[model samples]
Target: MKPEIAVLDIQGQYRIHTEFYRSDTPQNTIILVNGSMSTTASFAQTVKNLHPHLNVVLYDQPYAGQSKPHNRHQTPLTQELEADVLLELIEHFDVQYVLSFSWGGTAALTALASSPRRIEKAVISSFSPLINVPMRNYLERGRRCLADCNRTQVGNLVNDTLGKHLPSLFKRFNYRHVSTLAEHEYAQMHFHINQVLSGDPQCYLKATQRIEIPVLFINGEWDEYTAANDARQFAYAIRDSQFVSVENTGHFLDMEHKQASHISKIALLDFLKPPAPVITRPAQRLSVAL
Candidate 1:
């Protein structure tokens, strides 16, 4: 299938945008979700490499990208609400498999635990049981960066972590800020992060324990965002799951390694070979919706 951008109506708002790409062979459909403050662009290139076997869909999480905003007058998107958004995407795309990154991984797992029968297969990355991991360091850094309105440090932090000594690439990873976002948008990004970190480990532990699906855990050997230890711990919680750490790779595994036939693909290929279990429903935002 060819690549096309499509928007799905959810709860009367079409603010959330999805980039839909189908595989010529249609091996499977994977509904991909971006992380906090990130957009669908994160998974753009991966769709191309996966086009041979997967109809990949990448979408903005509500209130993060060009998607819906969280109104102070209304409710913020909880794990429940986010899970509902996942369900809407699945039904719209006829998705049977899910691929999520960082923050989105927790939400994806929450959906699995809530609606065990709906998720057939999943792959989560740079994501873990945040409750178990000490999120204070990440939260503090992110908070200070936002408070100071320091996109430069925020940008440099990511580049430095992933690129290590390479200084040139920091701006590239900060596409959402350095390029796409405005000053006001940066503030919104911070606010979103605050909401996520405020609840911390306690909020997500319950969500993490609820996952009961075939899950694949992946991390970059140098993933500063989601540590290898965190990924391994997360994989351990899900029964019959595999954890893989890409060598010489940073947080941006799909991008840095898109061209090379890396070991990550081996894990992915092996996972897809097994038949997915039959699903029944979902953990939608509307908790009772399922």
Candidate 2:
């Protein structure tokens, strides 16, 4: 399904590029939030699959893709700012569900905690509110590489870390893309890593505690980047949250290790799919011909 494209102006400060995939029938809308370094274009397949069942909204966050910040003053994208932008979009589009991946979950969680009236349910993948020690180390390494203008080191860092358990071909592709990042892109990376490093655990805890809607948190069993245990802890903080670990997988649950992708997909779809409407037949009046 082709999406209706639009550029949303956020209080006239910046514009975010968005794609709306409407279902044949009017259905509840679900927003697909991208992870760091990912864009709306990456969700092409997802939009196609979901548009048939639900209205899907895909947008590029500021500094991520087409959502470039016009105001140079607001250069770096912060978690709070992203959350505010997401909330505005939710209100504007009347979104009812959310599916966030990796770093994208940060904004989703924050928005749901702050203003969850419009969001009934959410699915968060490979995300943890608190940054564990391993995650911090990886972030710090990536930050240093960016700071030192060693962009090429990013590929090796990721291959040896987050992408370690991914397929070899995926590792090569990841390396090619990440290792050759442009100067401006590297700067954005620095900002993202720094924001996470500086995040307050207490703040995340409070925010998660505020969440009252049902949420499903999925993480790879072998994930060391975000640490599956940490993701479990984050899920535990919420009043209504379920945590699932995809077995034989690493940070990227979609990598299809031992059919992990299939498992994760099934779990997500089962949780997100709205219940089928019940059909009832009117009782026929008894024939009173007698």
Candidate 3:
């Protein structure tokens, strides 16, 4: 890691933490926003592997990871604010591509919604489409669950919710690694959830349709509830989108699957490097798009 690690002020309102991976030249610039509970370290495989030729920059999303907390007591910083930060960072570093996972995907699209012209190609992995049916219902339950946070409920959340997609091998896995994060980090993570689950509550659906950049969405096949089917529904709504369903993986495609790595290398890389995509609604709408 020959790159520098530091933070830059964004209009003096918010701070953007940036990490430049050395070796990867200026061929491609990817701004990766991890999930609510994750950070740049979680995406180490991609960041290190795509280096020398690809300038991969990963940052903390709002209150998650190592980012500064919100200025006010707001659950999530405005999607517009996130976009503004991304535009500033992109312009500063000349970034054109992005890879978003989970909540970060929502943030990425939200940023794109606010400023469609800032990004060119985006690879969204195992992201939440925020569909009205499942999204609302699950989130409503999650809020109630958090209200009564206890060991039993936490265990249930891990098992019934997060563990629903994993194989039996994961059932026996130790949770000590999961509990390693500090208290503030955990609370901040919950704060990020409020952003993802209920943040922009009044405008989430509209934002999804507003995405104009060419997006490649990759979803796992065996994910319990959040799987390729969910990604397919997300693909239908977006005007210009591509969906690739991983055959033998769960929700954690980046870590659990091998073919996904290949997809990023071959198909994903090919699509990203070329003429820029039109940054608005497509010229025409197809019934079975993406």
Candidate 4:
């Protein structure tokens, strides 16, 4: 059966659009966060795979999918704000693990760091703690194209930045999604991009340092935006985080490559396995003293 969609009013300020998939025999609850431009729909397959063993929650950010519309004025949605929304959802659903993709990783890490006791494990995919020069340049170009409302230029830039790296089949899908974005959606994405560019990389790194739960960093081996080295650096910052590079994968590890998707699922399941319960022995009566 399909999951039910719901809206959460966060502190009466933000309305978060979410989908919840309940498992018959739930072991843990996973909160899935989509990338900057993507929505909860992007993770349809992932939720299906995890639903048998876990109760999964998928949500769109404030400006992103079915959530409330936002524009340039809301430019710079701070990671703290994003973390706040996510924390509310976690508390509502009693989420135990968080799984984030691309830009969503920032908010996930922030929440985990701020409230270490609330989460048990986290899996971050295709995210970089620090933005590299090439990625910055690409984002800048995309922003300029978007500002000018030049669809042709935007398409060309996206192709040059992302399409060239993806396989032919996935490239077409990527282009279709990018080309069809509404103007408000485009603006929202641009605002997110700007926020990421202006963010302090050290903050995310420090957040990782403060995380005590198990963290799994998954990156595509050939992802241009987030290099493997950057993923490794993020893992290194966390005390005992694990890093996995999906072979022959690009930015969209779960969607583009089946092997990579399989690997990611395995890693996630292994990391999220519930710890053995500690058995406590009952105290002996005072008969011995008598």
Query: Residue-wise lDDT of candidate 4 within 71-112, one digit each (tens)?
Result: 223454667888998999999999999999887887888888
- Per-residue lDDT, model 1, residue 265, is 63
What would the TM-scores of all predictions be? 0.78, 0.88, 0.74, 0.86
The TM-score that candidate 1 achieves is 0.78
Q: What clash count goes with each model? A: 7, 0, 5, 0
Q: What is the C-alpha lDDT profile of model 2 across 44-91, one tens digit per residue? A: 555654667788899987665666544343467677788988988898
Model 4 residue 183 CA deviation (Å) reads 2.7
Query: Candidates' lDDT values, in order?
Result: 0.66, 0.79, 0.63, 0.79
Error of 1 at 21 (Å): 1.1
Scored by TM-score, the top model is 2
Superior candidate under TM-score, 2 versus 4: 2
lDDT for 159 in candidate 4 is: 63
lDDT of 3 by residue, 108-130 (tens): 77777765455778888776554
Cα lDDT tens digits, model 1, 80-123, are 67887888878878888888877777568777767645468888
Candidate 3 lDDT (Cα, 0 to 1): 0.63
- Model 3 segments beyond 4 Å from truth? 68-80, 130-141, 148-160, 163-205, 275-290
